[model samples]
Target: MPELIILLLFMVAAGIVAVEIKDLLASVIALGAVGFTVAIGFIVLQAPDLAIVQIVIEILAVVFFVAVILKTTHVDSTIGRPYKGADIFTFIIFGVFALAFLYVGVRFLLINSSAGFEIAQHYIKHGLTETGAVNRVAAVILDYRALDTLGEATVLFTAVIGVLAVLRLEGRKK
Candidate 1:
C-alpha cells in the first residue's frame, strides 16, 4: 500500500513538473524520470518484461530528445522572475486537476485490474499452444502483434529522420 502511494505521488509530481517547468532540458529529464518511475512500479508489480520495455523505450525517447536539444540549443535559464498571482492560480488549478485524475485513475485501476489479469492469464495458459513462443509477451509482439511493432518502428524511424533533417538544416545555415 505504501509503495503504491509513493508511486502515485511520483506520478503526480511528474505530471506537475512536466507541465510547470519552462526549461526544455528540465522537462525532458522530468519526462525520463516519470518513465523510469513507472517502469519500477511495473517491476514491483511482477512485470519485469514490461518494465524493461518501458525503460528501453523511454530511454530511447530521452536520447532522441536530448540529442535534438543539444544540437539545437544551449543555455541556462534565469530563476529570478518575480512570482505573480497568476502563477499561484495556475498552480492551484493544475494541482486540483492532478488530484482528480489521481483519484479516477486509482479507482479505475482497482476496478479494471482483474479483467486485465484475466487476459494475461489466458495468454499464459495457452500461449505456447497457439503461438509456440515461450515468452508470451514476445509472442504477442513478434508474431501475433508484429503490425503494431512495425508501426512503432516506423514512427521511431520518422522521428530520427526528422531530427537528422533539422540538424542538417542547421549545418547548412552555418
Candidate 2:
C-alpha cells in the first residue's frame, strides 16, 4: 500500500510537471516518466503483460515527441501567448474534476473485484472462438474493439501530420 501511494504520487507529480514545464524536451521527459511510473503501477498490480506494453508504448511515444520537438523551430508555441483570466478559471475547473476523479478512482480501486469480472471471464473464455483470433488480446483489440483501435491510429496519424505542417510553416518563415 505504501509502495502504491508512492508510485501514484510520482505519477501525479510527473504529470503536473509535464504540463507545467515550459521546455518541450523536459515536458516530454516528464511525460515519459509518468508513463514509466504507470508501468510500475501495473507491475505492482501484478499485470506484467500490461507493464511491458506500457513501457514499450512509452518509449515509442517519447521518441516521437522528441522527433517532433527537434523538427520544429520553437520548443513551445505558448512562449509568447499571454495568459488570461480564462486560463486560471480553466485550471480551477480542471482541479475540481481531478479531485473528483481521484476520489472516485480510489474508491473503485479499493474493491476486491470489479462488477465486470464475469464479463471479463466470458471474454477470456470465448473471445478467440467468437472472433476467430488465436489470441484473446488480438481478438479483443482487432475484432471486438476494431473501431477504437482504428480511431487511435487515426488520431496518431493526425498528430504527426499536424506537427509536420507546423514545422513546414515554421521553416518557410525563416
Candidate 3:
C-alpha cells in the first residue's frame, strides 16, 4: 500500500512538473518520469503484461517527444512575469474539475471489481478453445482483441510518421 502511495505521488508530481516546467528538455524528462512511474504502478498491480506494454509505449512516446523537441529551435530563456488574473482563474477552475474527476475516478474504481475478474476468468478458461492459441495472452491480443491491437499499432505508426515529418522539416529548414 505504501509502495502504491509512493508511486501515485511520483505520478502526480511528475505530471505537474512536466506541465509547469519552462524548459522543454526538463519537461520531456519529467513526462518520461511520469510514464516510468505509471509502468511501475502497473507492475505493482500484478499486471506484468500491462507493465511491459506501458513501458514500451512510454519509451516510444518519450523518444518521439524528444525527437520533435530537438527538431525545433529552442528558446534560450523565458521572460519572468506575474501571473495574470485570467491565468489564476483558469487554474482555479481546472483545480476544481481535477478534484471532482479524482473523486469520481476513485469511486468508480472501488465499485464491484469482482466483475472485472469474471471476464478475465472467462478468458482464461475459454481462450485456447476459442482462439486455438497456445498462449492465453497471445490469443487474447491476436484473436479476441485483434482490432484493439491493430488500432494501437496504427497509432504508433502514425506517431512515428509525425516524428519523421518533423525531422524532415528540420532538415529542409537547415
Candidate 4:
C-alpha cells in the first residue's frame, strides 16, 4: 500500500539521519523516530499487538539511549576519520545479527504454518463459547491468551521500572 511505502521511506530516511548526524542526542532521537515509524507501520498493517509491543520497546530503547548518552562522554575525535577496522567489525556483527533474525523468522513461519492456522480456527470457533464473552476479540485477548497478555504487561512494567531506575539521580539531598 501507499501508506506502507511512505512509512518505509520515512523509516529509511530517519535511519540515515540517525547514522549520519554529528550530534549524538539528535541521532538517538532520529533513531527513535525510525522505531516509532515502524510501530505506526505495524498499526497500519493491522497488527495492533505488534504495534503495541514495538511502541513500548521503542520508548524504552530511546529512554535508555538518551540516558546513556547523557551519562557518557560525547566527545568523538574520530568522527571525521574513517576507521576501516571498526567499520568492518560493525558490518560483520550486524550481518550476523541479521542472519540470525532471518533464520529465526523463517523457522517460526515454517514451524507454525499449519499449527498456527489450527489455533486460529480453534479460537474463532470456540472463543465466545469457551470464554463466555460477548465479543470474540475480547474472549481471545482476555481469556484464551491471558498468559500472553500478562507477559506483555509484565514486559511493559519492567521497561517502565528500568526507565525510572535509569533516570533516578543519585546522591540528591532532601
Pick by TM-score: which candidate is best?
3
Q: TM-score each candidate.
A: 0.63, 0.63, 0.71, 0.63
- Model 2's number of clashes is 0
Name the candidate, 3 or 4, with the larger lDDT value. 4
lDDT of each: 0.86, 0.86, 0.85, 0.86
lDDT of 3 by residue, 1-174 (tens): 999999998889989988777788888899999998888898999878889989998998899788878988444265356779998999999999999999998788679677777887888998878988867778888988999999989998998899678657445455
What digit string (tens of lDDT, one per residue) describes model 4 on residues 1-174? 999999999999999988877788888999999999999998999877778879998998999888888899555455777669988999999999999999999999999899778987887788777888866666777897889889989998998899789879896789
Which residues of candidate 3, in runs, are more than 4 Å off?
74-80, 84-102, 157-174
Among residues 3 or more apart in sequence or in different chains, the pairs in candidate 1 whose N, CA or C atoms overlap within 3 Å are: none
Residue 125: error of model 1 in Å?
2.2
Provide the global lDDT of candidate 2 against the true structure.
Answer: 0.86
Models, CA RMSD each: 4.9, 5.1, 4.0, 4.6
Q: Candidate 2's residue-wise lDDT over 120-143, tens digit each?
A: 788888886798776666677888
Cα error, residue 20 of model 4, in Å, equals: 2.8
- Alpha-carbon error at 131 in model 3, in Å? 2.6
